[model samples]
Target: MSLRPRDMPKLRDQTLRHLDDPTSNLRAKTGDENATGLDGLASHLRVGGLYWVAPDMAALAMSSGSQLAAARWATADRPTPCGLIMFDGGIGHFDARGVQIPIEACAWGPYEGECMLWLLMSRRRLVAEMARANLRLDEEQAPPLLPVHGFTVPVTTQPAPLADLDPSVPLPVIAALAASWLLMQQPNLIDRTRERPDKSVRRSYARAGREDPEVTVVDLRRQYVPDTADPDSGRDGRHYRHRWVVSGHWRNQPHGPGQSERRQTWIESYVKGPDGAPLLSTERVNVWRR
Candidate 1:
């Protein structure tokens, strides 16, 4: 797979379409990982960012400890390709205790074939491609993170964004900010880029759902307290309930440097009023780091 700029879109489509086929040689995994066939290798890759990479390059990128390594690799004169477009040792799906690192929204590689099929590009390879052609980082805000070999890399994996793989949907600001921070502590977000974006949280949420981008984020809120503070006051009220996709792994975990995971809570404020109960209002997702 010589994945140049022109090759990505078509290659991505084929992989996604055949991702679930267990018998297919290109299928992500072969045995145990595909035993059930329901959550096959491709499915895992999709849950991940669908980035693929080869072993040597994967190791090189991981060793570089930054997603920005692509910037460096592109200008470096290396002996072997930092990565092959697509090649998997003797086995296309070789299982070599592969390295899987969390870099912002994208998952890097299954370096030595630890089963999970990753559609990943080594950070260097990916960035190099992005530089050579027209590729833009719309909502990818998480900073470069050092790579770790196992599933226990300690970076919180955010719920894949609605516009993750889709370039058509306009970027969701606050939502994207909130989601990116879930992966790594973006120092640039607070000091450098805070004032750069003028889009409001209210606008991001409103436009994101109203347009029905990709992944749907539903905001469910309920009034638990009745205004009169009496059960027999005939006030109709309800409790808030809704499921938002959360990080399936690495909750409250730490990664490189001295940075620690901060406690996060989403609080909905309400006060009792003279009326029996207040009607539901508009929904907004605000991102704050203070």
Candidate 2:
């Protein structure tokens, strides 16, 4: 039920070996084309938003050659400049018989910019552990199978230092702390759905366990042009010379006893344009959301 501190090193090593094994069935095509769709999904991530990573996305990340590429894919389309990103999904790896096995895992980051920490735990292991601990979840709620420890990998070439986390502390504690932090953000639930052409079909939320989940696109990013007639004729008689959407992100705020500790705070997306004027950048992003 609880992870022992002494076993953390062994667990970390085993996880790394499994992930780096060359004979594993986690390989994926190494090219821009294969990653384009995954990149599109990554773009929809909003600060404090939850996404269920698809198999393709997980496979791409597990591929040895696509580490850097996968890293780029995760941060490519961000709702904000920077903050915590969370996702849970199945990671594929080969067993002794060369059979691909799916491992359930959850990841959180950009602890040190462009770095993600993953907690890998098999579904069987999770179920066994929960049974041993006599833990139960409501029928409508998803299982909370967060692992006790995990391994960290760089999502980008130049990753920031892991200064926020203390190595002396147990990883499981850190993971629990991160989960609590994420919950405090009140993360938005990202729904994945496909539009029915008939339009008469009622929506259903039951889980069918599909590998490639269908997702709907929601464009929150819009281009804003200032009014020429009256530069200051906008809301509250205030307008900007340039208008642009500022993506939502997270910020660190001092908190806890004596304010000795810091916590992540969510910053909502907003428009930037002082006086009604022209737009700054014509480039726009095709953001996909539930």
Candidate 3:
């Protein structure tokens, strides 16, 4: 869809209406390393800070990955088209040994065939359009758009640690960190550039937890779910469950590439229901390289 600076306000209002609408459903798949669906795809778009329409198709398989490529031209502004907007190959499948290996099989393309219906409105454009919408992407020197908040959950199929929760760091902050790390690791699924908050946001988050204190990182517990169970409401209700070792330590410069000293620890985590119980338990152990 072509959107100009003037049309941003209406777009934003409509986008938010759909996003917040109780009738609008959000669907997602939990596992399947090679799995692709509307939820994850939509999440990627939302995380990029764009408002989009509901996807029309579920998941499908196409034999030829080349012919499968779908492209569309979208204009970011009024005068000229911004760029050639293309579908990044929703998902593809290949038959192997009579088994449909769309996800597990190597050489298979990133999920192909799913289409996203979007009513995107640039955050900057929205602000300019609305006399009182005082938000500026340039003030932050970032993307002029703010991704939707529907898909911020971790993508890993395993649950998070429950017992021995990090006393130093708040659960919410750690969850936020996990979400950030997951997004950073999987740039394809989500871009790190858009998520990077100014130093202030990070400072606010880090100020609460043990800063420059001991650092702990847990081992990764992995789970792969192919047949992701999505909610009936069309929401990507995929659950992530995993265990990891929690470690604590100190380094002269945090995240610094150069040399530094550090400490560590081991802790277990898994998904839990609202009642506060193990959602899924496994023999997986949490350990660090050190």
Give the clash count for each candidate: 7, 9, 43
Ranking by TM-score: 2, 1, 3
**lDDT (CA) per prediction:** 0.28, 0.35, 0.25
lDDT of 2: 0.35
lDDT of 2 by residue, 220-277 (tens): 1233222224322455865456766665444455666899855444344455675455
* Candidate ranking (lDDT, best to worst): 2, 1, 3
Tens-digit lDDT track for model 1 on 1-290?
A: 43322232233334444544555443333446434332333344343322223333233223222221111111011111111122122111212255322222222223232222122323344454466678854223211111111120111233232333224221221122233223223232112111111235335536656321121111111222212232222356644332221211123334445755332222112233334344444465332112
Q: Any idea how many clashes model 3 has?
A: 43
Cα shift from native, residue 87, model 2 (Å): 5.0
Best by TM-score: 2
Best of the two (2, 3) by TM-score: 2
**Candidate 1 segments exceeding 4 Å error:** 1-9, 27-29, 36-40, 44-290
RMSD of each: 20.8, 18.1, 23.8
Reference-based lDDT, residue 62, model 3: 21
